[model samples]
Target: MSGRSAAARVDEADYIVVGAGSAGAALAARLTEDPDVTVLLLEAGAPDTALELHVPAAFSKLFRGPFDWNYDTVPQPALEDRTVYWPRGKTLGGSSSLNAMMWVRGFAADYDEWADAAGPAWSWEALVPYFRRVERTEDPADPTQGAAGAQPIEHQRDPRPQTAAFLDAAREAGHRVTAANLPAGQGFSRTMVSQHRGSRSSTADAYLRPANGRPNLRVVTGALVRRVTFEAGPDDPAVPRATGVYLEIDGITRHARARREVILCGGAVNTPQLLLLSGIGPAEHLGERGIRIVAHSPEVGEGLRDHLVAGLAPAARGGTLYAAEKPAELANYLLRRRGMLTSNVAEAYGFVRTAVADRIGMAADLPDIEIIFASAPYVGEGLVPLPAEGLTVGAILLRPRSRGTIRLASTDPRDKPLIDPGYLSDADGIDAETLRAGLAACEELIDTDAMRTVTTGGWIQPAGGEHMTPVERAELAMRRYSHTLYHPVGTARMGTDSSSVVDPALRVRGVSGLRVADASVMPNLIRGHTNAPAIVIGEVAADLLRGRSSSR
Candidate 1:
């Protein structure tokens, strides 16, 4: 059976924003604020009306469900040919609706690096305002943190005792407890999430929902954009102008014309996929797929980067989040909006520079690894259900040296892209060695008396890791158990260099009336989760649209 309906009539709008996701939702809302601009936002998934979408703890349940794109990468050689499952939200808020709800702003130095790759306007100082504009944080350590922005960021309302123990263990292990959002932020802290009270505050909830009533704004769900429709420029026949998008809505093929611009916020994966499908990627690749070349951009799906984590689970003494699966916990969530259901799984996070990174002369401003503490055992890279009552402490590589690619599987838009996240493929093996150090830190943290008190039984993941040297165990575990943290970026990286798919202004090279404002345009992966930065990118796009000279 066909996934879409029969062809429908053409639609027209002043502007068309593809993918009502983390960036699209915000950008569409911001653009429509002008009232003069009639904006149409298209989403491939259904609306975010499900109760589970708002419940923090239920995020994992949405995976492989109707709301997820449910993408799986090609077999990774470094991870023993494991084809990692990559879950991206197919709903209005994109992955923001399905993410762990972390609101990390990323390290300042990471943005500085972006500035180097793109332009000075992308520096930390220039982007901070956009960060503040997108967030409404509560009780942030820095006064500069957003206090009254569209998205609500709240401290964890109900942190697990196991997580508290993990923090103490981190401190005992000589790790400082610092804020993850500040320039000098580092250390262990309860995670701050994009939530309102206890409910998940997705971009849909924060930006799109509020602008839902606008007459100038129109949101259509279940609209699959196949390709960007282009026309030859008036004077320059060689240059193409994106007039609109060719999409399938209600199984009906239709054209949604954009009078002004067609902005793509389809995230790191889909944005590049759409570009490639529209024949905007590598000439040879598109030719092989029988796709007519509209624009030949060789770097479209290159430079893919993602975070990988080694699971470090230990059996817990008593209290774990498993009890939340019961009826009583659901009742607690219904009545008081508190309990395990309010948890965002990975409830605590920290950034650290391991001895390996420091000794290797890596950038001191960037963290080599990030420690994530989950109240419950998250096995099988969170694809597997909780096996038992336990605590999970993951050692995540922050800045992996390896790069990957997203390529066309076929000319058909329905076909999934070929994802090759060349993880741990660095020539120097630095990515693997850095992860080893992080896993060692995880071992050090868990071995502390503070963590040991909460941990009762033996290690759940990499059972009996203590037998071998910590580095050896980490290497084994990394090869055996390392999986994506679900933060992928840089596929359609923005820069001034010839290899860049998009310029610093986010305009696709050799194309007009088209722009990309999403994680895909990030020149470098931030030293944090991609959610906050993605939203900030939307804010920056809005500012640019409003005729701002630069982000600063």
Candidate 2:
């Protein structure tokens, strides 16, 4: 059920933030720190009280459930015309609650790339303090990692035996094994997770929960935001000022007026959808849906990018997470917080500078591929359990040249947006070539002595035996069995150019009193995971909004 009905009637606030997910939760919490500012956070889903949400290894169980947005992509021609499953969190913490919880900050050079697009303020140098301000790492060995912040991050308390073997293989294969989230952003290591005392610590737990006692903060769950309410700007009538939002709480439609600003943190998928629904998208696209155009922004839902991974699950001997759900293991987890249940599935990760486009100077020294090790068979897109004992070696394309879009499916707010990641559809074929190189690395890792100790030496996934050639296997993995790492960004790209959806400060270019603070505003993708970066975006957005003296 939705939250308190009495608060549904409570409307006006100093600030209105939509989608109490990663960015919105952190922003609303930080905004209310003023005590004088009244902040309203509207979530389209239920509370983050699900038992599955708190369990580190139970993340896949939340997929396709009520707690998930459960989106699917249009059939991709490059991927054997298979529609990929895209599971976004629909709860308080948003995807952070449902993610594998890896706190991987990409290389310093990658954020320097952000400096090229946006301003130097987004550079790795300038954003490091914001990154530091977002996380409270349990024991940060690296100077780049934050030691005192809201988010709780730590090394896994109990990783699977196979996970350690995976890192051993990385080192044995001559890959550097180093600490996580270093500014250099090279090498392999045991993943640092967003957890506290072996339990998942989402933005809801880290940011929102602590701020709940504040008198000025009102968090509304199950509140479906329909569209942004706007009026004529005082300075320019052609430019609209976001007055507030029109949302449905329970059954009745209500208006929540924002005296200062309206921020959209619905993420890469929903933020663009909400913007398009509010008549702030392409003039022709809004015309097709019979929506009145408020702004003619053409780039609202364009430039969608995500991390596409091809997972290879090989048959394994005993000692994997295959028995993590057994009664004794559950008891071990509940009693002492030590067991396989504390595993984040994808336990260890490494970066690879593939041979593709390296000599040509295309993305030189940047990680073009990522290697992920999960000590379980992540078959059926995680819709089912590990049928037998197996370990997954996932090869992910780190820098995708392919860009897609998130478009409106219908005028109704309930209808999910049309998401087309266009996986591996890059014109130069570099994306496909990079993934093939990642597949070769996975094969190399699997052949190492460290990995040979655990595996039984056969394929469990790709729906076949180990009879296929390496070339054939790599091609098959690319054509099929590929899924998202759940890092979608760059839809509402932030840049210094006028063509960008939002400015470097994250304000919507043609709108007043409106901004987007989510993965959607990323000018481009990072070389690592998106969860930590999304939280950092929220932290920076809070500072920017606080510094503003007048409406645009």
Candidate 3:
């Protein structure tokens, strides 16, 4: 599939899935399984089967490169007036190729809240089979699990010494360490990566590549979708029903009709933007932009949520860190698929309650914050090499109460949308008490006997010192070190209400033959990294399109 000329007015298909990312790949693979269902997948970026994408540690290089969309957020007032950089995948595998390969299932209660918020079928108990179906866990047949049906899920084979040390430190800090993706009561543990052997198993590698040769599937790269074209009646003042998509490839415009459905898998930001561009958002906002108002769905691009993380670097012993520049290490990885090349950096993590009680307080079974420990610091500010020897830990606040919005920059599809995460802007807004408690947890872990062995002084901001008062430290932490956990969701939310862009069945409200199958459809943010759940959404959407019950 190389150097293929753009064909004008391409052939029609049973389904047109946009964005060959995590969700799109899964949906395409599942839909094409039925040979009768012709599926056409459109991707704005080219294929990335490069060695760089396969190496787990090389993910840093992929960011802001040709494969990435390279988006930036408006200045976030909460983080000391800093503008955060958001790197999303625009390639064949989408963000999965560029993301940390941690296979977190979030918390069980996370899905229960989904059911309560979105609909009943979204609950943990109801969605467990889908999770299990799409996962081939490293340890299967334990009744607790097994890897049998979908993608391969395994623990890192030779975790960096620092990863083990971090786990030991957590134990020393009086926090129980357990497997990260287990059932709710199993407690906290190291992350189980979505890896097959030593290589990163991106959605393209796991699902798309294998389906490449299928006669029923046609994957067109470098095609940028401008808007969904609707079939309209002459006298009707209402929005037309979507029957196809208008796209451009190599300076040529074309349209492909979908007999069954046009699925938008362009991710959170792009999905909402596409809908608004198609004239299906807030009536006033659309009309103000000189665009025709369609459905008038006020919530088309509302309810944006993301995980905010803060990084902490601690001293490390010599010979512990993996230096990719070293000849010996690079050769080892290149020849044997071992050494630093296989490392996903963020190899260990744990979920714990920052406060004594749950943040929601309705259930006794949930954890508030999740701490992700990396062997090396791969932060948004770029990779900061440790001082000859040091390690870093990232504390992420999952399930933030803060909400944001995604609005169109203009009617042009090429123009990137305005993504305002509005981080930490909750009704209560920046909670000093919760942040201080989180800091205390971090302090406890660093003060542990295991961590003390390699310790230097604490590296808290504010520059006054680690001994700064809790108030001072909290203020400094808030201002100095907040960053994205890379998990963004809830832009095009799903609900039964009229304001929602999509209904519970994942179908667009007031739009015919169109649906959204990606993180954007999530009514609320899940409690962990969203990569795995995003893939599951694609799988479920495929089943629904094939007339299978979502309960399956």
Q: What is candidate 1's lDDT per residue for 219-337, written digit by digit as tens? A: 88888999999999767878999999998876678888999889999988999999998879999999998998998999999999999988778888877897878998899999998
lDDT of 2 at 286: 99
- Summarize candidate 2's per-residue lDDT along 1-552 as a digit string, tens digits: 124433555588989999888888899998999989999888988888778898898999999998899999999999999999999999999999899999888889888988899998888888888888887997787887889889999989998888889999998999999988888847998999999989999999999989988889888888899999999999999899999999997777888899999999999999999999999989999999999999889999999999999978889998888899999888888898779898888898999987785854765567788999999988888988789999989899988999999999999999989999999998988899889999999999998999999998888876565888777888888788898999999999999999999998899988899999999999888989998888888988998988842122
- Model 3 CA deviation exceeding 4 Å by range: 1-9, 141-146, 233-239, 320-322, 356-362, 383-388, 430-432, 458-474, 550-552
Q: Any residue pairs clashing in model 3, and if so which? A: 136-147, 137-147, 140-145, 140-146, 178-188, 178-189, 316-390
Among the numbered candidates, top TM-score falls to 2
Angstrom error of the Cα, residue 23, model 1: value is 0.3
Candidate 1: where is the Cα deviation over 4 Å? 1-10, 464-469, 549-552
RMSD to true structure for each model, in Å: 2.6, 2.3, 2.6
Clashing pairs in 1: 4-251, 5-251, 6-252, 7-253
TM-score of each: 0.96, 0.97, 0.94
